[model samples]
Target: MPAGGLDIRTFDAVKALAFIGDLSMGQPTDHSLRTAWLAAQIAGAASFRADICDTVREASLLRWSGCTANAAEFTNTFGDDVEGRAAMLAERPDWAELLNAQGGPAQAIAPLAQIHCEVSGEVARILGLGSETEATLRHIFETWDGNGMPNQLNGKAVPAAVFVVALAGDLEIFSRVYGLEHALVLIAHRANFRYPATLTIPVNTHAAQWLDTLAQLAPAALDAALLTPQMQHSTSPDLIADVLDLKLPWMTGYSRAVATTAAACCARLVADPEASERVYRAGLIHGIGRAAVPNAIWDTPTRLSAAQWEKVRLVPYWTSRAGKQMGTLDQATELASYAYERLDGSGYFRAVGGPALGLEARILAASAAWVALRSKRPWRDALSDVAASELLRTEAEQGRFDSDVVEALLEGEPTATQSASPRNIRYAAETTRLSSREIDVLNLISHGASNKEAARALNLSPSTVRTHVERVFRKLECTTRAAATLKASAMGLLR
Candidate 1:
């Protein structure tokens, strides 16, 4: 795909995570990049060493990395997770009032924050960031006064780099969301709480000048900071797919299913291995931009309002922007951005006709549509393969999908396409060292089964099943169920 074999590991971990983090936080796509840039400046001005400044920059980029892991909880706490979190970040005037109306204490976010911290920390660990960066991210939401999320550690107990990053984030977010005056007011209000006064005071004095200068350099400078050639531990773009799918439970493993089918279709129809592999990668991340929109919009069964639809159309545009920050994933994500386009010029973000579209674009679009058709949606039962094929063929006839691509998906389709699931993946079971019973348990839990549910299905006691699940986690070296599932999938042990 990139003049060599499909080397999936070359994905820029910072860009992929930062893009997802920004979307989950309801900030602009470059929000994390700007935040990281601001954090580095603050850290630099504080006379921190270059390495510490680098940690601050990276910590800021991944500040919201765990946001998706807590999306459902956030939606339950606040109707619109995106807007609610965005409002909280900007310290909107009515944010306090809105929280009061919820009749929930500030501490309610602790559990959500705990989940957030653990997942973010694990992501950092998996990405091979240093222990300091991981530690800083785990404490990113904490404050100096101990009125923070998760641990609530006070006054110097938190990592020093975190405070600098926090102050920088405030300056960047408030200055952009509100104005410099209100931003300064907000930053000053948080002195001795959000960060040490030593780090906080100078920002109020120089933020205007700093932000003005940042505006000139932030675009190129921030991009350079966020986009790297690769990480020490190479990461897969599938991680991006996994993290995004977490925001919606029903969509578990959805990306892989799309990818599996897309690859198979491309291989059969196009007969180009490299092109097929590229399509597969695109399928895995086609919905990364869907993170920018809230769960509420995607969960809707009915037609989206005109305003809501406009936001949905920008999904592709956001995906493309993320691509720019992604180093090796540049082309794959660009292909992903076109997944929604239709050959009839009836698609969104860009409405180009059949003549302008490439074969890979057509294959990805068809593959994505077919996957959606076969997969279950909130409003309806999953369509059977036959039923999905009928609908897909109808769309192809109407010029919405490429007829050949649609036929390729329908013809050479994996019988397990609906479950185009991990069931069929090769089992390097010995590699995971999981026993048959443990494999069965891991498979069940990975599909969203609870311990009791898995136990019942396996005809084993819940305690035994719990023990087995714990063993699976230990062996897989995962903490969260999502992490366990991902690792198990990667190990080909999910089956």
Candidate 2:
């Protein structure tokens, strides 16, 4: 829905985040979006301002945004946070059930509630929500009179969005678990205190029957949704690279650190403006595919099985898929997809020869490997800087990575400390939007087809195709076919 296609501003942050809540709640996919829509309708009917209703809708969808930030921590504390939330739909906990059960359910449940609330508030703050919005999110679980954890500000002080979102969220859960009739009865009973009397009256009035109204709506209502143009788009080359780190809570800082180190390594190379930007973009989105992989695998400190390794290999592939739907990002996507490839054909998804992998991609591959080796993951503690360097060199010697990029990373750097600050790096690289013809030419170039072959395929004369290829090369800054390939890959030109 963004004017320039699928840049950062194209994807609705609220809608995308609702998917996360759906995952956390163990709901059928897209359940959060539907619940959000239903909640917005309820808010609209309750004399709420249109913008406030929209905010409530947005908050309903994104209220669980921070849950992914600490998934491992949550899983550790509660046997399975994902599974526990799933159970909430059908089962009501009895205090007597706790008294008769083994160990401490009450103690565990309280902290989990507090942790979820606090983390949600933290994510709201990080996303730059307004103060009123932040306050609403913080008190999402508060009872009207007082009892919410992580500090309850009580009734009137709570943001309207929070009150509507909380009630709407629970109503959906209840409706799904029990019949709609039961859900409405429950809301009517809770009306005065737990539910705001004004909002509760309408939800009890229409929502129980209107639950089926969503069926009249199409799927991927989310697909048609738009992010406002006012949101700042991250054009940093590290955009996708840094995004990968956000796949889990504990990894919040990993992608940014790796991107910084990788950019520093690339800085030592020939500074073609286009190539520099391409490499940075590759670093940011390189790990976005990790979203398809479950947090269970990501958080495991133990070794992985063959099945897990296969799942791991698919992350880059998925990252590429995510980019294709976005406009004008082909080069960045391609680089991100192939970031794991090795020169010796040891990587995944069609293991092409070194010629297909391009210089920019090679730099990204090496940089990614170096940063990954240096960072701590579930299976291992971070390697010493010296050890990480040795590992990179070992890979280079085996012809798996570009020696030039590796050398640049190592130049004037015997010790492996942090790379240059990401904040200091200039991201003012000029970007030209690619036209359809240019995109077609670049896609063929990525396949290692010559200009003549591309011309035949596109029904254009060789001269015209050559001109386009030359322009693409100049715009992307590559003298050789390999560099062009890297840029294309970074932009996600390849499928």
Candidate 3:
């Protein structure tokens, strides 16, 4: 077993994330787990090697990891009913037919598929899956007839494990949604095109038995049974954080940075070792809920609608729920759930404030604010150390942020420089169309500044500030200050 007690439980934790991925894709929570279980059963029927069967199971559970990263693009192209549509498409044998039916051009869908595959491979690597497993995941959609997205590997060119997962995933869905006979017919029809004949034969022969066994086993029991010793793997808080951060390009290293800074603050505040560790872990996974939100919102340079803002607020709540599902992460997840909360009860998901917010939560909030300020975002440039510190102090004075926590963060690193690299800064600027002045107005407004205060801060007239605010609102498609702030924060535009 690897150090830190990850062991087989790590696989369970990954499966939990896959469960979240299922929800993100608009499927039932057990969708990925059921797929993994079904895939393993099919692999067993095919008499595949033990290691290959394991890979098939892992790949099946994680097949949709990329979907979190590409959800915005998918929703924008396909519509808000992505889950139903995606399920429908998955049942179809022809990818080209589905795309044509959806009125999505192949050229547009191709890059999305490539990104999805690449991100899936990255998740596999981060979770320490072997090269074979990683490769299988990358080629999960490649068809037997060289007609799949991202890559068109034909026949034996596609990984055998991937073929097993492909057939099993479809079989599970079809069998569950339709009857066994109809599922068999669908499998037979797609035998030579969607899945290789070799794999399809085994699936067709044992489809009923596999379906019956899956139906008999409880999802929890199935998960427990699959956590065999050999499935154990090494993982750490950083690895998990990377997986969550992969949901958005702009949030690439946000979690790790927050964890690092939060740990430092905890140390400076003389927190117990356990408290420090818990806070660090909490900071790392605090944004796990981000995966549930569409990237279009994260990437939107403009303001979000009130409906969109509602989705943004629930991210922390989702993170808490996800943590609760993992037996080992209950405490840390609770802390993470408070990462977005403010001392003044203005925070979201749960509006608990003041005494309800503990020391650890305060440190997390301060550290998160500090890190975000130092990171480049689409609406504004990274704040200078002096400016960020001043902002924190100002918020504290207004009873919104914790003054002691803010001081602890500042004292933890008196000379800390901005951590946003030049490349990231450039990337943020390039992807956003907001001008520096407009960004300035938005930033002030996000912090609860009225037009007059914003005007004074930027050395402009109140009327000019109002005009800038209107322009910002118009560009962002928002009607209220709260909506603008929520939208800006979702896009990583706020500290």
Candidate 4:
């Protein structure tokens, strides 16, 4: 784990999803994380199984994960989705009035329907969630009285996680926006209506305690327990998936899938175990940078304007940043970021030729593209496997993908392995050297620590922590914490 906080992976996937949720609705940030913690406590108090508690926490984070993927539609009907959501929260309205405010119902139905299904599906698939969990997310908006979106699943049809998350989410929001007493009252009022009556009281009670204990708990206390020993023991494949997903919802489980696919492909090419593990880890974090990007750009349904596209292109940079913060991922970060580059100078950030690109990078690029194409998107339906293959082939012929890597990817061939081939593993010559304090700050940042949290951990003022963060970015040739972390990992400073 990095200094400022844990590596993005150690926390529950739900926390990351909740971050996206908070961003989607423009809520006071950290609402999702707080809510998730509350939900976990509620689950424990209610005597839910340990697996159920974990599931509840994960669901709480994912409940709103899909909300951002449909931002364009929400913005179109509501005129700025973020602002509209904020208004709705400030003044709770009747369902009828809320629908009417959503552009007189007619214009809103399609977008709303699209939002419900698309978001539900995206969140579930991205997390590699089980069908039960997916069903839970799909029915998150259902009412006990049989009025909700799509198919109205009433009461028991909803999963326990849904009930727990819903109750906790509402409780946290109300408590933060209003007061603890008011939050309790609100929870009581919504019981059996928006909430499952049986779970509401327990959830609300636990939430109240959480709010009271807020000051006493360590910044990392709740999150620290969510991770498994494997994550800390060694950066396992599942650990990588967890880390990437927790950092960026859009990239939930993305690295894991890529790692699995790439390692399988590479294994056929060679039998060196260490090389295989390295290749796998490389695949696991290829999209960590996607976390630094706002959900608005990531979930937009329409074609990105030129400005938005630039933001899209920054995901790799952020991935590299997180790697640098971890101390031993600098080379991995570079390969991850360059996964988007074309062989013919048509790629982003850098346009280095295919020959110059690493074999790991070429496979990562092809695998990422393949997975993305086959996976559904807000604007377009997912492509068939054949269609995705053809697209990769087209890019390869265009001089974007490496010829051998493309063939391997298309034919299901293995990653070519030469016995521990020499590779560049240092920070770019242009990268600035950060001080030890700056590196510490960067590590805390990659773990999602707030300035206050970082300050407390390091015995520094919030203002001082912020200053150190700024210095880290300047010296590392990066801007965000995610980027700085990746730069450090590239330099082996984060380890």
Global CA lDDT computed for model 1: 0.76
- Per-residue CA lDDT of model 1 for 1-495, tens digit only, reads 222354444227567878888888888877887877778778877899877887887788788888887787788777788888898888776777777777754555777777788777766765667788889988888988988877778867898988988888888888888888888888888898878889976676677777777678745565665443234336555566766777776676778778778888888876567887798789888888888888888788987899889989998988888888787788999999998999999997899867888988998888888777777786777898889889999989998988888887778734342231232122234344888888789778766678999989999999999999889878776556766655555454532
Count clashes in each candidate, considering only residues at least 3 apart in sequence or on different chains.
0, 30, 2, 24
lDDT of 2 by residue, 76-186 (tens): 654455565566544566433532352453444445555456545544443455555556666666766555544555777667787788678778878887878887777
Q: What ordering of candidates by lDDT runs from best to worst?
A: 1, 3, 2, 4
Q: Write the per-residue lDDT of candidate 3 for residues 1-495, one digit (tens) a residue.
A: 011232225574576567557656666667777888888887887898988888888888888876655554566665542443445545554545556776664565766676667667756755667788889978878888888877677767888888788887778777767777888888888888888677777776777777677779974688685664434744554545655654544565577678768877887786367777888778877987776666666666778889888988988988887764565677788899899899999998899899999999999998899988976776677898899999999999998788988988898654222122211121244227567898788867765467998899999999999998998778765455544543454344543
Off-target runs (Cα >4 Å) in candidate 3 are: 1-9, 68-98, 101-106, 174-186, 197-220, 228-230, 414-495
In model 4, state the lDDT of residue 211.
77
In model 2, what is the error at residue 458, expressed in angstroms?
Answer: 64
Those runs of model 2 whose alpha carbons end farther than 4 Å from true positions after fitting are 1-32, 88-106, 113-115, 171-194, 197-201, 204-252, 266-275, 288-296, 307-314, 317-337, 341-345, 348-361, 397-399, 402-405, 412-495
Cα lDDT for residue 440, model 2?
82
Write candidate 4's Cα lDDT for 1-495 as tens digits.
Answer: 101211234233344345445655667546666777788878888889876776766666666665544444565566546656665664566534766866654466544644454445434543455565666776676666655555566666767677777788887788777888887888888887777688776655566567777546664665564442322332122333443344333343345557656665555555655555555666666665554455566667899999879876876665555443343454555566776767776776666665777666666677677766765566788788788878888888888877677667667632221111111123335334666787677756654568998899999999999999887766654444443433343343432
Cα-based TM-score, every candidate: 0.87, 0.64, 0.73, 0.48
Candidates 1 and 3 compared: the better one by lDDT is: 1
